[model samples]
Target chain A: MLKSAKMVMERARELAAKRRPVVAIAGAEDDDVLRAVSEAVRAGIVGATLVGQEVRIHALLEELGEDRNSFEIVNAENPKAVIALSVELCSSGRAQILMKGKVSTPDLMKAVLSPRAGLKVGKLLSHCAVLEATGYHKLLSITDGGVLSNPDFNDKLAIVENAVHVSRVIGVAEPKVGLLGVMNEPDPDFPSTIEAAAVARSCYVKGMTKYIEGPLTMGTIFRQMPEGATWKSDVVGDADILVAHSIEEANIAVKALINLRGAIFMGVITGAKVPLSLVSRADPPENKLASLALAAVISGASK
Target chain B: MTFQELQTRAQHIRPARMDVVGATPFEISIIEKWEKRGWKVRYREGELEHCLQAAVDAAACGETDLLFCSGADNLKLIRFLDRAVSRDYKPLTMLQGFEVPSYPKVLWVGFTPMARYDSIPDAIKGVSVVAKSMAELGEPEARIALLSCVELISPGVHSTIWEATLAHMSQRGQFGKARVDGPLAFDLAVSPQAVSNKGFKSEIHGQADVVIPPDLNSFCTLTDEIHLTGPHTAVGIVVGGPCPIALPPHRDERHMTLSLQVASLLV
Candidate 1:
């Protein structure tokens, strides 16, 4: 029901005030990350636990004109230890959300996927970017852009489920999922079309028919449906989630929507025990704040 | 339509004065047919080297504004005329099929080497010129579809990126007097049923006046598929210059006459 990113932030603020999820930041020396975390703390959205060098964290806090004792800082020796401690904080019920700060994504992911001290919940970890542009009627979610390379049938299913979970936490009761493909029909030459049809069939057989539709195009989801068409689906032109076949497809579409269409978005890694706030280094401070808000809301709902 | 009817339509826009050069006897006889329909037709006798001189002479006389070339083999003359008229010249081809009953007319463009457009800006430039020429030829508000394998702009798929960029540019008023929609496949570009079934909402959906492919290779393959496999009539016109130059496939009388009729509107 949240039509814009502003509404998403408003809903997240309301949920955070009710639950007050504790957010653990791994490699938390980045200024943009601290800015967003500080804003969320000021709004009473979430409490933060910073995991990094104590001296650097204190310096950043002072540089941002905040009191040194306002936040909890965990001193760690290296990036690996920082990620391990943050994951431990989330797994031990000390923190509700895990976020990546200045560390590389692969390094953070390695720690999160580590069997001994990871946040895996026996599901595939996929990335979902939630976007709200001017022309769209509601917020749109594109999934598996940053994590999965070439997702198979099961990976796509998990990706869709993860996106649906996030959408539900953000207030959409039943998210309409669109399995994106080149065309509607299943062509022998195109493997994506075949996979799309298989995914659609899987969703149908699993009694999740009301939640998904595909082999659809981006235009069918963003623009008006073709006039006088007999095909029946609720996802066309009103899709809450778009499940792409590959990382390249999802990444290109997401980047184009953000870069070309001027869409505001928040990126997160889902399908974990707790939602992970993961964003690109090029993302603005507002986007990082929105990601924090998103993590807070999803974490609160998961409880 | 008949030559007389074509001349009448041409008169509505502008009176066409044509200068023909380096054509076969059969080609000249076709222009003679237009002469019978009250068209001002002048035939200049020239070999390959004399083509540029002949076109310049025709233009200098102020009697002929449009120059019709014999075939694509006269690249030197096409280049010379292209430079003489305008700096930007894009060759536009119209693929007409009577055998396939569903979709009749499709404009396949940017196939010629002289009209090779690779980047986004060049593709948009070519499409804008062709769309404007189509509008002047009587179809106002031409629907242009940027052809690709799919509608989504995926990485490693350069055509889809170019198509998305052109569509964005068109949305931002970069291409004038054209309703452009793209990254569309061939089915969605031409078939109304495909457009309806796919649930695509676009101005050019199922009703495209011009179809600009991603590059020259795809355009060649598409044109060949339609020409060899199906019974169809295809003709090429180089626009975006001061005048339209026809680049017909063959030197046959039918093609030359049809190309001349098309060039008359732009001239």
Candidate 2:
């Protein structure tokens, strides 16, 4: 299992030494996007292919003091064509990783999920936001924070499966997953709590994950657990993944750690033909690079 | 007023009758402690629902000024209290007062265990009760934040739209002497440094006296995370009824003392 987020960066570098993954940046006209992607290429983790207005990409790379010869530039004048060519590169094995640059999430997702020229597989797409909190020993992943707003039973199971895939990509062979809720036991009054319990139990029966348990709270998953508990207290304080009850619940917890605990953050959208790094504009450069590295590692390993 | 100041003020109010339901030794001692402070206290012993019925009936009828109740079923207590009080009073919302060791003033939070607000109207009603309670607590112009995970108002995220609309409404003096703003995150709502660092202009610059989470799940996750990992005290009560209902934040009776002390005078 990966000890920390830094190890993911190191592993990506090692993978690049053997076979570097080619990352295609869609809408690569933004300055922040070029800066972050170039940093990953400079660190020898991934090769670069810029797909956007070629003139703008060249100007940005030049302003950032980067060599133009390092990247294979594709000219797509409009947003539609830019995203299409980027997804096509991944679909045709020309690139293994797809990184979103300076494009709205909905716009980029449209091309990535196109029917004929898309990267979508049968599995549903879900987001996994991995964090390295200041005081924690290992990395923890919170799922469906950016996608799947109000997930039903099957959606949650798929979300967990997607997060498990990301966990394994970071070297964790078997990750303990916790379905979080307000109570550890299913309360009929709270239907979401019952849903969490049902999902956790189904995963356990199918042996879908290493250790799956819930209707657990954040106190059990990430913080302290109550004493004398009967229901699967084994995942307490050692859970590798926390499957949130809703998107808002996951987003709130994710931001709380970032704002309060000073957590190092990186996110990925999985269950696709290839992993996607939907790097946020609000994220710092290091956080954006971390996402790129994670995507590069997952994409490189999948090949 | 801070919780200490609120408690100090409660001690000086004219002695009033209090009805305690499901009184254990711990709850009884809490009542006895208040009784020694020149307040009239009474304990009713029986089944939880029965005592809650009797206490709610008495408080709703002005036979008592404060009702001290405890039970494992928080929803049951709320439903019974609402049904009995709604005959003569409007429905209520629960507001909690927290005095963290590092915080500057009492953080007033509005939330519900059973109330899930997904629309703008439901959300406004929730904040209205908590804001009204803050007005009752000597903060006529309280700064209230409609808390969310992000500050930007996105059409896709329902909570942010509701919060932004409510924040815009606050400009017309809709809340009456209160400055309400949000879609503020936890950090921007509470940390002045975060507000300054983000460089976003807001009505409440991280000195919010009140914060209303968008839903029950966020409420539970955020509050429980803070309570478990931090050293602090909390006092809570249900407001906008005929009388303020004392609902302690913790299972321990020590926290109930301040809640009872504050609710007694607010009634």
Candidate 3:
């Protein structure tokens, strides 16, 4: 199992070294995007195809003191065209991963979700953020922080499936998912607890993930199991993935870990035909590089 | 359990003006203990209706600050008093001991969900008020954990969102004299080992003075579980009113004493 975010990146680099996955970046005119892609190529983690204005990309490459011929560059008239061309590259199997550049998040998501793009895999498209903090022993993944504002019972199932898919690609044989709630006990008054219980019960038959426990607190996942705890299981201190009840909670927690706890994180949109590298504009170059690495690992595993 | 011990323990509390209505023999026996300790107790005989009437009359005459109701099973009377008193009364149930036996004494509230406010704000206010009350009980500074399944807020998970809001409010000093952290789980709020294992650094980690449940249903279930399966004693009281009201778990001697002790602390 990949225990930390560093391990996740290391695993991706290893897999990419064995079989270099091609990554196509939409609106790749941004300097940060070019810089990250340049680093990934140097590390032998990915082969990049830049989909954007050819002239501007060439100028940036030259400005950054790079050889323009070192990589492939696809010319596009605009951001929309760049997204279309990038999605086509992945759909045609020329690229195994899709990376976002300067395009707005909604615009990039719109292109991926478009029926005409053929990138939709008939699964709920959700966001999964993998975190490596100082205190945690393993890299923890929180889902649906960027997409799916209010996921219902079935949506939660799909979210878990999506996370499980990513976990398997990262070499986790069995991923334990904690269906987070306010407390460990289920309460009907709070519908989230009720939904968490329902999800936990269905996990037995669904078998999409290895282990699932609900109404789990962060303490249960990250902290040691408390004394006199009646409910005892493996998921209590070893959860690899935390299935958040809502996007707001997932977002708050992930951001808090990153900002308050000084944790390193990478986010990718899963459930698509190919894993999409979805790095925020505010993310540093290293984070963007990690996102690409993550996509490559997921893409390699999906194959 | 004896008069001398009760006197020493309740010395910090003043001679509280209390009205006991609908007292059974068991309740009378417990009230007698307080009487022997030099506390005045006014008695009223009858059912819930009689008890309510006496309570209303006492409040009208300004004869009592606290009301003790014997054998009041449902929370209808409390709700009625809440409306009549025109103050938002939150029913606070405290687990008498630590969830972990080795841990120090702590106050856990909001086990009973608020019927007045919708789930999240109700829980937030309930927790805030209880944390404040516990501070008044001489903890000075109370560490409160507003518990949810997880610490993150989800759109459909209203309690988590509200808990987050409460935490933020506490940071802004909205909750006076209370250090509130949420949405915590039971283990995170009280287990030091869990805090260290997770590498989470929180002041309330494993040292919570109070644990607030998201709603009433969970509170009731948790109390039942602890009482039935464990050896810990659980006691409940209705606070955030004009005065603290004692709602005993049962008409047994132990419960009555526990309720009186809780009421005395409030006084």
Off by over 4 Å in 1: B1-267
| Separate DockQ for every predicted complex | 0.03, 0.33, 0.05
Q: What ranges in model 2 sit over 4 Å off?
A: A38-44, A61-72, A134-137, A220-232, A284-286, B1-17, B27-31, B73-84, B87-91, B97-108, B119-121, B138-141, B147-165, B181-209, B229-235, B251-267
- TM-score, each model? 0.57, 0.85, 0.59
Q: Which has the greatest TM-score?
A: 2
Q: What shift in Å separates residue B44 of candidate 1 from its native position after superposition?
A: 28
- For model 1, the local distance difference test gives 0.69
Worst 10 residues of 3 chain A by lDDT: A252-261
Q: Write the per-residue lDDT of candidate 1 for residues A133-239, one digit (tens) a residue.
A: 65667888888767875577888888887888888877788788988765555666456768888898897677653668777755455555645667777887688
Lowest summed-lDDT stretch of 10 residues in model 1 chain A? A252-261
Give a tens-digit lDDT track for model 1, residues B70-171.
633433445555445433443433332112223455444443334545555556667777667766766657787877646666665556777787788888
Which tens-of-lDDT digit does each residue in A208-251 have in candidate 2? 77688888877666666666665546688888898888777787
Question: Residue B220 lDDT in model 3?
Answer: 41
Lowest lDDT sum, 10 consecutive residues, model 2 chain A, at A224-233
lDDT of model 1, residue A252 = 48
Query: Model 1 chain B: which ten-residue window has the lowest total lDDT?
Result: B92-101
Q: Is candidate 1 or candidate 3 better by TM-score?
A: 3
